[model samples]
Target chain A: MNAVKAIFLKELRVEFRNKQMINSYLILSLMIIASFRFAFSIIDFSITELASPILWISFFFGGMFSLSPIYKREIEQGTKEGLLLTPISPSSIYFGKLFANLFIIFCLELFILLLFFVFFPVNIPDLFSLLCIIVISTIGITALGNLISAISSNLSQSEVMLPVLLVPVLLFTVIMSSVSVTSNVFAGANIFDVLDEVRLILAFDVVFIAVGYLLIDYILEE
Target chain B: MLKNKLRILVSILAIIFILISVYFALIYTPPHEIMGDVQRIFYFHVASAWISYLAFGVTFFAGVMYLKSKDFKWDNIAFSSAEIGILFCTLGIITGSLWARPIWGVFWRWEDIKLFITFVLWLIFIAYLALRANAKSRTSKANLSAVFGIIGLICIPFSFGANRIWQQYHPTILVSSEGSLQPSMALSLIISVIAFTFLYIYILLVRVDIEKMKEEIDKLKQKVGG
Candidate 1:
């Protein structure tokens, strides 16, 4: 438990000190939202219908940008070797990084969601249900992204390789999440309507988190 | 020398079998009443998709072997087979779209689960190739790609299920709530399956040979330099 907490704090401290990741994600998300707003102004159709896909598109790109640096930074600084030299288990390292990435992105997601609501009219009668969908969907994305980032960090073009490797695997997660969020926003569907999406997200989180924990040791080894 | 001869024999037999299968498809098998001659495209479309799936399965297994043995040879085989698989998969997607265009009135539709999954498969392997191309070291590239190849394969089931979960417009191919296929269509499809399977094996052998030759060249270069 101490090891896990230590690793998690180390990751958070590094992220806080650098701030590049947070800045890049926030700027990219803002640009996406602003562009969507401009495009909506040009078009005559209802923005509410377009809101779901647009929000997800922003989140997708934001998630990709946020994750691209997860391991590459460590690799560049040769901190991976230092981290491996620690007494902590690889699974701890895996979950620590996973949690750190999820926390930063979750915060970014909240900021973006807030900006989204302010910029666009995204009304839901049940805020709790909407929040639940976002949280579940984000878990799936972060889990899969962290694993792929670890794998991609070892490759030459880690930046380019990360997204290429990740997007296809996460395609289902994105689509399902988007559909659930959209249904909630537009149709005002009951929680039962979004249950399938939530279940899929949960399954994805469980599987990828396990895979990440199992594979990180192999990945970290020279 | 014996292996070479066997490869040649298999290649020749595959050619003959594929020719016979095409003959059966074009002349022997009657066209569907609903889809007309366009239905004939199913023979090639389904065959290529099956071959692609088989090739990817080989890739997945080869990846496992490479990871287990850390053998560069297995990695080479996995990479080459994945390339071939992508090639056949591309053809499958094209032929499928060509068939769908005339019948479904669209060359591409995201609603088709099989089609969408095939496209995703193509992207995954293409990315695998791109990763290999960019890697600095041979071992690292191979290991990374093998892991990816396995993981990419594991995602196929989920991608296939995406349509069912989301209520998409893609046609369910196997175990449809609708009844089984008509006997004639099923028979033609079966013949095409046998023919394409042979063809896939033949192509895989050829690709593996080329990979071996490249490996030999690399070895010779290293020896001379050293």
Candidate 2:
């Protein structure tokens, strides 16, 4: 537990100091918002309906882009080995990395969602439900991303391979997130409407996290 | 020697079965009232999907075998199976698109759960093969690939369920709310299933044998060098 916190805080500090992850995420989100705004200005469609899908798209691709630096940076500095040699369990290391990545992506997602709402006239009937969906879907994304990024960091083409390996597996998360958000936007945040999507995301997150934890020790074995 | 003989036997039988299946698919199976000629593609398309599933199942089994035995042979089998699975899955997706063009009036739609999931499956295995190619050591490559093979197999169910849960338009193909298949199409599908399973087994055996021969040649080369 202490090791998990230590690693988690260590990663958070590194991420904060470097600011690469947050900078890229913010830039990409702004670009997506700008593109959509430009396109919508020409074509007359209700921005409210499009808000959820656009927000999810930004988050999904942005989260994917953020994965390279998470593990690749550690591997490049040879810090991964040093961290592994510590008394921390591999699962703790896995979870800590996962949690940190999730936090970064979740924060990015929330910011994008806020930006989308400001730009568009989307009204959330239930803020709590939307937050739940966001957190659950983000877990699913980061859990799988953590595992694949760990694998990719060791590969020659970590940059390209992470997305190539991840996008497919994480498609489920992306689809579910899109569906949940879309339903919330169009249908007034009915719990029943988004229940299946939320459940699927939650179930997938749990399963992948468990699998990633069990396999991380072997994956990190020298 | 016996194994070689058996391989030959299987190959011959597979060839015969495939020829018979194609004949049945083209000439014997009556055209559907709605889908017409395009429906014929379903025989091959569905067969390829079956073959893909069978290949992945072998991959999953061989993955476990490699982990348990730590033998290079099982790893070879797993790799060969994944290769075969990817081929069949590709064929499946292409045929499905061809079928969809006439029926759905669109060749590809991301909303279709099955099509999307199948594409993802294809990409996952392709990544697995890429990982294998880039690894530095043989043992490390095999071990890593085996782990990936198992993890990818485990992911299939979630992928499938996710698609289904989203209420997408992709045909479930295997069970219906009302009940079983629609008789004629079901029979034709079953025959195609058998034919494709035979094809899968034949291809797998040939690939495994080729891998074994390559290993033997590598051993000979090492012996000469030493």
Candidate 3:
């Protein structure tokens, strides 16, 4: 408990002590969202129907792109070795990174969600359900992202490699379920009607996190 | 060498099976009542799908073994099997889409759970290969991809079941033993499956050997540098 909290605190301190990452991420996401506005400018359909996919696409990719450096600093400065030398269980390290990723992504995604509402507003029939979708999907995304970034952090080209590896495997289930719930809500479906997608996202989060937890030791093998 | 002789035997055997299977498929098997020559694709299509699953099964097994024994040999087998699995999986998807277009009036069916699962499964293996490519060290590549290989195997059932969670009817051909297929068609299907399985084995052997030779060259390079 103490080790996990300490590591978690350290991560947060590193994250906020320098606001460079968050500031850049905020700008990057807004730029992508603006470009999307231009890209869909010529489409004939109501932009409201396009809102869910756009929101999820920008936030998901933005969250993913922001992750290219999650472990780079640790790896480059040999800080990961220092942490490993401590008596903290590797699973705790996994949890610390997982939580940090989940928090940072949620913040970034919330920023994009607010921006999206302004550009192409859709009445989210159930705010609670939409929140559920965001929270669960973020967990699933970061769970997989942490492992992928960990895998790529030691490589020569971490930036290009993470997405090529991460997108295909995680994108299908996460995007499909997230889009399902969000679009259903946009179309004024009741929260009960969206339970199936919610369940799928929940189940995906559990399975993904559990798998990452169990496999982290193997991935970080000496 | 004895190994060379065995390779010759296996190669000859695979060739013969493929020829006989092709003959049985096109000539010996009678055409379907509702559909004509196009149903012939079913033999190789279903067979390739089955063999692709088999190749992935070998990969899953090799992954488990590598994690247990930490042997580079098992990693080689896993890597080769995944490559072969992706090839056959792609063939399966193309052939399946071609079949769907003629009969179902759509090139792809989102409602068909099997089709969806096969597409996702194809994506998973492609990602597995991409992950393998990104790893810098030989051991790390093997270890990381082995972990992913096991995870990918677990996703097989989930991807198959993913659509079933919404709608039940997925149009499975596995339940075809109830006299739906004629005796001649059954025989052709069996022969096609056998041929493809042998083809899988032959390719696996050649691929693993190539991996070994590459490793040998790498070691020789290191020795010269050292």
Candidate 4:
């Protein structure tokens, strides 16, 4: 507990101190949401149709851009080696990175979601459920992305490679559930309607975290 | 070498089997009563789908074995199978989309959960291939990729079920039950599936051999230079 908390705090402090990734995430999220809003300024699709895809796409892509720096910075600074040798459980390192990533991505998505409603005036029928979807999907993405970033951090051109690797992982399962829940929530469906998707998102987060915990050791093997 | 003879034999057999299957498909099987001649593409489409699954199946098992054993040969097999799987998956998706254009009136349908999920699976494996490409060392590549392969296999169930769980209201594009198949269509489908399986094995054999040869050359280079 202490090790994971220490690592988590350390990563959080370092990230806030730099704020480079956080700023870029904000800009990218705004750009995606704003551009799509403009592109659809004429069509006028329902909030259920337009806002859901735009919201999820912006958040996923925005967080995707921010994700690589979680590990890429470590690899770049030669600090990943020091972190690995810290006598902490490897899974603690994985969870620490995952928690940090989940925090950044969740905040970025929340910003995009808020900006989305601000621009479009789309009413989310269930603000609480929408938040649940965002938080669940963010957990899933962060767990998967942190591991993928670790795998690709040692590779050249990790920024480009991260999305190529992360998008596919998200596409089939997590993104689908997130989009489903978001769509249903905006469509004014009853909460029961979105429960299945919520469960799916929850399950995916567990699976991703488990995969990371078991495999991070092998990935960091030197 | 003995392996050379075996390769030639498999290559010739694959060629002959594919020829016979095409002949049967074109000349032997009857056209659909409803969809007409565009239905002929079904023979190859279904076969390609199965072969793609077969390729990924090999990758999945080989990947698991590689992780357990730490043998590069298993990694080689996984890599070879994944390469073959992606090719066949592309073929399957293209063929399905082409079939969809005339029948479903759209080249792509969001409601068609099977094709959409297949496309997603296709995307995931493409990422798998990229991971394999980005690794600097053979062992690391094997290690990372094997983990991904396991995850991909786990996702298969959800991909198969995504449509049913998502919307009870959407249309299922393909309906195949036990009694839906006419005898001639069934025979033709089986023949083509067998032929495609042979082709898959032949291609994978060639790819694995090439990978092995590359490794041997690298080994020889290190021996001479180092």
Candidate 5:
């Protein structure tokens, strides 16, 4: 736990110091949300009808931006081996990075959700339930995102490879279920009303977290 | 010599079964009462879908074995199976679209869970192959793509159950208790499936052999360069 905490803090400190990833995330989120808002307005579809897909698309794009740096920076800085040499287990490194990425993603998602509501003006009856859904859905995204970023970081073109690798795996299961639940919430359905989708997202998070934890060592193998 | 003979036998058998299956599907089976001749696409569509799933399943198993044993042979098997899986998956999607155009009056339906899930599966494996191409080292390629192969396997359940789960407009042809498939249609479907399975095995055998040969050539190049 301490090791996980230390790594997590180190990640936070680095991000806080440079703010490179967070700044990119903010700009990227804004661009996605703005472009989407314009696109929807041109189409003249009810923003309320299309709110969830647009929101999740922004999250997905911004989340991908944040995740790419998870391990790519360590590798580029030639610090991955040094981090591995530490007494900390590989799973600690994974969880620490996952938690760090989750923190960043969660913040970005809340900001995007706020921006979404401001631009689209969709109503939600239960804010807390929506927040819960966002947290769970983001967990599912980052849990797999961090691990996949670790994998893609080993490749020559990590940036290009990250989305290509991440999108399809998440689209049908995590992203789809998240969109479903979020749309339900936006449609005035409570958390219980969308329990099935929420449960699917939860299961996706658990399965990928377990897979990532068990397999991180292999991906990190020298 | 015996391996060569077995390969030829399997190849010939696959060809013969496929021809027979086509005849059964096109000529032997009665035309659908409602849809008529275009329904023949069903046998091939379902068969391709079956082979694609089986190929991915094999790839997943080979990936686990590669990770467990750290054997490049298993890596080769996984790569070969994934390639074949993508091919058959593409065939399945195209056939499905062709069937959908006349019947559903649209080439594709985004709202349909089964079609969307299958397309997603296709996208995931294409990414798998792309990752394989971009990887720098043989070991890294094996290790990383093996992990990816396992991750990709999760799509199988959602693909298989998409029609059932969402109750989408995608037809539940074979599995329904009321038996939508007549006896002749069932025979044709079975034959088509067996033929496609044989073709998968034959292609897999050839693909694995080619992969092994490529590894050997790489080893020789490294030896000579050193």
Candidate 6:
């Protein structure tokens, strides 16, 4: 627990200390959300109906931006050896990074959601359900993102490789369930109506987190 | 020498079965009652789909074994299987599209779960192959491919079950709720699958041998440089 907290706090401290990553995520997400505004005219399509996909797309990009550097910086600075040399379990390292990425991504997601409400004529019919969906889906996204980022960080072309590796894996798992459920939430469906998607996202979150936790050792192998 | 002879035997057997299967599909089986002869594509389409799925399953298993055992041989098997799987998958999609253009009046159906899942599966493995190509060292390639391969395999079930979470067009008539395939059609399909499976094995053997030779060449060059 202390190791997770220390690592988590260290990750946050690093991000806040520099703020370059957060700024890039902010600009990228804002651009994505702003471009989406022009793509869907309110005259042709209802923004409320389209809000779910728009928000998730922005979140996906933001999540990717945040995830890409999870281990790259460690490798670049040679802190990877320092971290590995610590008397800590690898699962601790994974979960700590996972949580930090989750926190950063969830914040960006909420920011994007707020922008959607302001920039587009969209509504959250059920705010609680929407938040639940965002949190659960973001967990799933961050879990898989951490694993893929770890894998990509080892490669030379980490930037291009991250999304190419991530998008397909996310397509059927996190993106599908979250977009579907978020749409239902936007459409004012009862919570029970979106239970299946919620369950699917939750199952994915559990599976990927466990897989990432177990697989971190192999991925971190020298 | 014996291995070479066995490979020749398998290649010959595969060619013969493929010819026989084509004959059975085209001449022996009666055309569909409503769709007519275009339905003959079903035999090859379904068989290719099955083989592609089988090939990917082998890739996943071999990937796991490679990770567990750290054997480059298993990595070779995984890579060869994935390459063949992609080929058959492309063939399956093309054949399916051709059939759909005639019957469904479209080359692709957006709402079909199987179509969506299969496309995603293709993209996932393509990404896997891309990662393998990009990796620098032998261990890096094996480790990364194994991890991605496992993740790709996991994504498949979720992709297939995406329909369950929402309404999707599930037009799975090739194997219906009741096992209702005509015996003759089934026979033709079985022969195609066997022929393709043999073809997969033969190609895999050749590819692995080539990979081994390449590694040998790399070693010799390194020794000469040293």
Q: What is the TM-score of chain B alone in each candidate?
A: 0.90, 0.89, 0.93, 0.91, 0.89, 0.91
What is candidate 2's lDDT per residue for B1-226, written digit by digit as tens?
9988888887887788788778878888777777777788888999998788778888878877887788999998999999999999999999998988877777887766678678877888998898888776777677777777777877777777766655542343432212234576777777878878877888888999899899899999999999
For residues B105-136, what per-residue lDDT tens digits would candidate 3 score against the true structure? 67887766677777777887888888887788
Give lDDT tens digits, candidate 6, residues A95-191: 9999998888878887887777777866667888888888887888889889999999998788999999999999666787677777788889756
Query: Which candidate should be chosen as best, given TM-score against the real structure?
Result: 6
A1-222: candidate 1 lDDT, tens digit per residue: 787788779888988887776687788888888888888887687665666677777788777888887788888988888988978888887788888888988888888888898889866667777677777778878877887888888887678888788878886645555554465556566566766656766776777777777666666667
Ranked candidates, highest DockQ first: 6, 5, 1, 4, 2, 3
Would candidate 5 be rated incorrect, acceptable, medium or high by CAPRI criteria? medium
Q: For model 3 chain B, give the 10-residue run with minimal summed lDDT.
A: B169-178
Clashing pairs in 1: none
lDDT of 5 by residue, B1-226 (tens): 9878888988998999999999999999998766678889999999999998898889899999999999999999999999999999999999999988877777987766667767877888899999999999999999999999898887556434432333422244332212267899999999999999999989998999999999899999999999
User: lDDT at B186 for candidate 6?
Assistant: 87
Task: Kindly list the per-residue Cα lDDT of model 4 for residues B78-195, writing each as its tens digit.
Answer: 9999988999999999999898888777788766666876787788789899888888777878998888888777776655545555564333645431235678888889899988
| Candidate 4 Cα deviation (angstroms), residue A210 | 1.6
Among these predicted structures, which one has the highest DockQ? Answer: 6
Instruction: Please give the DockQ score of every candidate, comma-separated.
Output: 0.50, 0.38, 0.37, 0.48, 0.57, 0.61
lDDT of 3: 0.80
| Stretches of model 3 off by over 4 angstroms after superposition | B1-9, B161-180
Candidate 1 TM-score, C-alpha based: 0.92
Q: Could you tell me how far off, in angstroms, the CA of residue B164 lies in candidate 2 after the best superposition?
A: 3.7
* Native-referenced DockQ of model 1: 0.50
The per-model lDDT (C-alpha) reads: 0.78, 0.77, 0.80, 0.80, 0.85, 0.85
Question: What local lDDT does model 3 show for residue A37?
Answer: 85
Per-residue lDDT of candidate 5, residues A77-190 (tens digit):
999989988888899999999998888788888889888878888877888888998899889789988989999999998899999998888766677667767776777888
The better-scoring model by TM-score among 2 and 6 is 6
TM-score of each predicted structure versus truth:
0.92, 0.87, 0.91, 0.92, 0.94, 0.95
